[model samples]
Target: MSGTVALITGASSGIGEAAALSLASRGASVALVARRADRLAELADRIRGEGGVALVVEADVTSQEAAVAAVRRTVDELGRLDTLVNNAGVMLLGPVVDAPVEEWQRMVSVNVLGLLYTAHAALPHLLAAATNGRRKVADMVNVSSVAGRVARNGSGVYNATKHAVGAFSESLRQEVTGRYVRISLVEPGAVSTELADHNRPEILETIRQRFADVERLEADDVADTIAYIVTRPRHVAVNELLVRPTQQQA
Candidate 1:
């Protein structure tokens, strides 16, 4: 991990923040990218205080231009890009019947379009780094969800977005694996993060009660999975990982 640069999106909090700390601790210089500038600055400070290199990139990945700029800035300033964690996403779950169309748009924008934009911008650099960097391989970890596998009544759009992520990751992985750039997917279930807060006020309690009996996973748990995928030996590509709390049956 030393001498490598990793860029993570949705890095202001939750899994993104945890992944940034985890990778930095392991010697990868981290670039924290999210719309929140203040939070990124704070995380950067914490990483630096721990003697780890950190870069704060404040941009909304929903915009293709911002995504491109973020990737370019990371390579220009950090020297090279070896890993990309596409963690920026939003979940606004509700029944498809008369649902807020805006919520569906938001999910598609962040979960699918944003991921595509960032990966497109980072691919060239990742390919270049894989050819000449210290590790001889590059990694792209796309954060997905269990919703990708199971389609519940109330989460149709969310399921669609995550399924798209899963599909895209597999195709991309096949296209790049021979070139030394590994594309992996990490799907998590019922994590205790701000993801649920994005739902409407009336839908919040239902989400909580549905998972009441289950002990949710912490952000660090998923972060550890991301770290494991990228830290594997060059020959070992952990293509996809699905993590769930012990009590989460589905």
Candidate 2:
């Protein structure tokens, strides 16, 4: 990944942070995008301490303009954009009845719209990089969820958003794969991230009990999966990967 530049959104914590560190270790100059500047700075320092290049761009991906600017800044500062990780997302789980409308909006805004905004801004650069950059191939990895594959009680809206991500990733992959731009979807099940921390108290309790018996995955686990996808040879494209804990059934 030396001489290549990768941009990751939602990079302050969890899988995004892990992916940034992993990619940096592999020699890719990383651009870390998130709303938290402090966290981004800390991560960037850590990357630099390891003799890796990192750029911190603070922006909210849910806004189109901010998302576009984030991509532009990465290219302006890092020279090229070879990989984009559209990983900014939220999961708010609850039954439809009496559920907070704000929760649904939040899920859709971050999980779906935010992904779209980042993808839109990064596609042109990714295409150009695929044809002109060192690797000769560009990657776009969308961090979806296992909920994308199966709908469940109390997670209807979350399911819808993730399903939308899968659909968008597949459609975009078909449109760009012929051009050496690979699009991949990573579906993670029961990862120990802050995703579940946003739920209401009742929903949070339900989630805790449901996963009480199962040992969940760590952020680095999914980050490893993403790193594998992007680090593959130009001719190899791992389109969709579903990673679940050994104890997770759904």
Candidate 3:
């Protein structure tokens, strides 16, 4: 992880934020991308204060232009790209019967479209870096969810978005593995993250209650897994990792 350049989406908080810190601690130059400029700046400052490199990029990953620019900015300032962690996602949990249409749209846009935007822009650079001796190995890690694997009733739209990510990551892995570029997907189950705050209050309360009995995994749990994925040797490509709390059933 040391001396790697990592671009983390949703780096302002939660898993994204934890990934930033974990990578930085191991000597990765982190590019923090999110809509929250203030939070990004704060995190960057914290990383710098601890003698690590960090860049704060304010943008909505859902925008193609913004996604491309974020990658450009990272390469421009940091010199090269080593890893891209697509960790930005949203969860709008509710029954399919009367689920909010807007929530479904938002989920699709942020989770699916945003991942594509970031991945598309970084492909050329990752491919180029992978062939070089100096930067022989580069990684692309997409953060999906347990919902991506299992279709839970209330998490239908969320599941759809995550499933798309899994499919895309696998297909991309096949395309780039021949080029020596690594592509991986991290499917997390019931980790404590800000995703819950995005849900409706009543729904949030009900969902929270289910996990109340067990000690849920922290955002850093997923972060640690991402750090491990990108830090592996150039020849090693971890296709997918599903990190779940011991108590989680679905």
Residues 46-151, model 2: lDDT tens digits: 9999999999999999899999999999999999999999999898898899988998898899999999999999999999999998889999999999999999
The backbone clash count of each candidate, in order, is: 0, 0, 0
**Model 3 TM-score?**
0.97
Q: Candidate 3, residue 198: CA error in Å?
A: 1.4
Residue pairs that clash (backbone atoms under 3 angstroms), model 1:
none
Q: Write one digit per residue (lDDT tens) for candidate 3, span 187-232.
A: 9988887889978899999888989987899999999899899878
All candidates in order of TM-score, best leading = 1, 2, 3
lDDT of each: 0.96, 0.96, 0.91
Instruction: Give, for candidate 1, the lowest lDDT window spanning 10 residues.
Output: 198-207
**TM-scores for candidates 1 onward, in order:** 0.99, 0.99, 0.97
- Alpha-carbon deviation at 229 in model 3, angstroms: 0.9
lDDT of 3 at 7: 94
Q: What lDDT does candidate 2 reach at residue 73?
A: 97
Off by over 4 Å in 2: none
Question: Which numbered prediction scores highest in lDDT against the true structure?
Answer: 1
